[model samples]
Target: MSIQSILDIGKSGITAQRLALEVTSENITNVNTPGYSRQTTIFQTSFVTEERGFPLGTGVNVAEIQRAYDDFLQTQLKTEASTTGWSSTVLASMKRAEQLFNEFTADGLGKSMQEFFAAWQDLTANPQGQPERQAVLARAQQVVDQFHRINGYLTDIKREANQSLEGITSDVNESLTRIASLNDQIKLIEIRGARANELRDQRDLLVRQLSEKVGITYLEQTDGTLNVSLSLGPPLVLGNKAAELSLEPDAANNGYYKIFATSPGDNTAVDISSIVGGPNNSQGRMGGTLQVRDSLVNGFLSDLDELASSLATEVNSLHSAGFGLNSSTGLDFFTAPTVTSGYSGIGGIQLAISKTADIAAASVDPVTGGTGNNLNSRAIASVYDKVLATSGGNMTMEAFYNALVGKVGVAVQDAQRSSDLSEGIIKQLDTLRESQSGVSLDEELANLIKYQKAYEGAAKLVNVGTEMLDTILGLIR
Candidate 1:
């Protein structure tokens, strides 16, 4: 080989080794950086020449730097992330609702119901006393107030869930736009035969974040761009462009939102609300929130309505049939709904009799062919045990409410267990992913030493080439 060729080989070795050292240094620098994938320098032999019957080897060339990536592992991570997000969200809200209905609390519904019935029993003992009559009114009002408070709190919880949906949608949109931009940048760099490792890492991190908000599927195209979409719906990002999701008010309930995804191919927005868990099962936070608002909170409110409506209906029926202190008749203890159906029981119910004397404690008055008795008062107190049709079978109001509370407790426990399981799965997947792609400082430090020695050796070869060239020049002179 010519001396000039020998010099070129040494120069190439020096450059390749230096680049390797630089990559090792970068890995060490970003060891603690989140979502930073470890990169390795790829070395390729430069062009070879056929001399006589043998090929002369050239020094190494620094090829593209490759990131440690596993597509299947990343996909699994995204799925687990979505699951964890969904379960955690549901568990948190369910726990919050459970705290409100805690039977251990003094102002709980069960306690109020008990006190209300006790007040009626007190009035049954002193049927002719005004103070006992006032106590019944106060306790009755307390019961209604408890119902209203629970209904109001549940409504507020549902509203908060809906408000969070807007933020989730906005975050999803931002991720889509950022992914599209990264796709463009990655494609540009890759087309020039370079690896955009950092960009790819950033894009993958965003994809995981997006998966937490809503389930997503992604594909890595040959052109170094990612095509992303909802797991069960339309494409969200394709090449350098991204499809947008728009929120419209639901037709059935204007307070809720119907989400639509617009595709670039057809430019038509398709309603994906159901598929995304609007009223269906979901694997992400958005689905969890919808479940809380539509199912959990709504179910509790319905039970409260049934309890209030049934209790009021039976009490008013017995009280109205009797005579009050002033010989008043046809007066309801609690206002009954005019319609048979579609009544929001707790919200619509009120005390029909404002005056304390209006309470119908007499089934008959003995003075004028009527008995002034406490028979009706005792009957009204017994309404708690009256197995109304709303109780679903022969269960009393107290038994029905107890069952409801027990059901909510069971639901909360299930949610918490699911969240814990999801977290465990996500933790395992994350550890596996980190082992594969995450930077290891110890490994990088070891690599730094090896590359440093190789760099030094390559520099010595360049020095030898310089010495050899100088010797050849001395011989020619």
Candidate 2:
């Protein structure tokens, strides 16, 4: 080989080795960075010349940097991330609702119901006692207040869950715009015969984050761009452009925010609340939050209204028929509920009678025609045991309320199990992804050492080439 050729080979070798060292250094620098994929330098022969029917090669060329990526694994991770987000969201809201119904609390519905019935029992035993009458009035108000308080708190929880819809959609929109921008950058880089390894990693991380906020279906195009869509329908991103999601107040949902998707070529937006918020849909965090708001918490409120309404109706029926000690008749002991359905079904319930003389504790004596007996008071207290049609037609008001509380507790437990299982699945997928794509400090250090040695060797070749060229020049002179 000519001395000039030796210099050319040494120069290319040094350049290739230097590029390889930089790639290794990048891996080591990003070893702790989240969602970072390890990169390796690719080498190729610069050229080949035929000499005496044999191929003579020049030194190495630095080819494209190869990024470690597995599309199928990443898809699995995104799916699990979506599931984990849904489960955790539902679990947290259910726990808060369960806390409100705790039976040990002094103001809990169960405690109030017990005190209410006990007060009636005392009034039944001493129908003329003013203190027993006053106790019954106090306990009745407590029961009514308990129902109102529980309904209010559950409504608040549902409202909070509804509020999350805005936050989640905002996050989803931000990620979509960022991903489209990266797609633009990635396409530009790849068109120039270079790999955008780091950019691809950032885009993948955004895609995963998007999945956690809302479920999506993604497809990678031949031109290195991602096409993303909602789980149900509506394109979110196409090529380098991203669609947007906006929240508008929905009249049908009592002023709750509804999600709307608008594409680039379309000015009209589509409402996707039912598609995303259906109880059977398992899309992502928004789905879970909607389930809690519209189904779980609202369902508890419905049950609460049922218990309060049934109790008030049954007691009023008995009390209005019996005559009071002062001959007061046809008066409801508790005000009647104005509505038959919804969370406010019990809102109008209160003590209809306030005076101790106003309580209808006496039943007209069968023969004496005197209103001095305790039969009506006993009957009002027994309404707690009467199986009302409002309460599934087989259980008393008390049993029905207790069963409702139990159902809430069970829901919390079930949600916790789902959350735990989803998180565990996500953790396992994360470990697998790290094993395949994550940077390892020990492995990076070893690679760094290897590249450093190669660089030293290339430096030596350059030195040798310089010395040989100097010797040939001296000989010619």
Whole-model lDDT per candidate: 0.82, 0.83
Worst 10 residues of 1 by lDDT: 338-347
lDDT of 2 by residue, 356-400 (tens): 888887777323565458888898888777777764558887678
For candidate 1, write residues 1-477 as lDDT tens digits.
Answer: 777777788888888888888899888888888788899988899989887778998878987788999989888889888888888888888777776675723678778888878788888887778899899999888877777777777777888887888888888889999999999999999898888999999999999999998988899999999999887788999998888888887768646877888875457899887778755558688878878877787887777777777777888888888877887888888778665332333547777887877888878752564443788889988887777666456688888787778867887898888888888888898799789998888888888888788878877877888899899899999
Which regions of candidate 1 deviate over 4 angstroms? 47-55, 265-267, 278-280, 338-346, 369-372
Model 2 CA lDDT for position 399: 75
Itemize residue pairs with steric clashes in candidate 1. 364-370, 364-371, 364-372, 365-370, 365-371, 365-372, 366-370, 366-371
**Clashes in candidate 2: how many?**
0
Which candidate leads in lDDT? 2
Clashes of each: 8, 0
lDDT of 1: 0.82
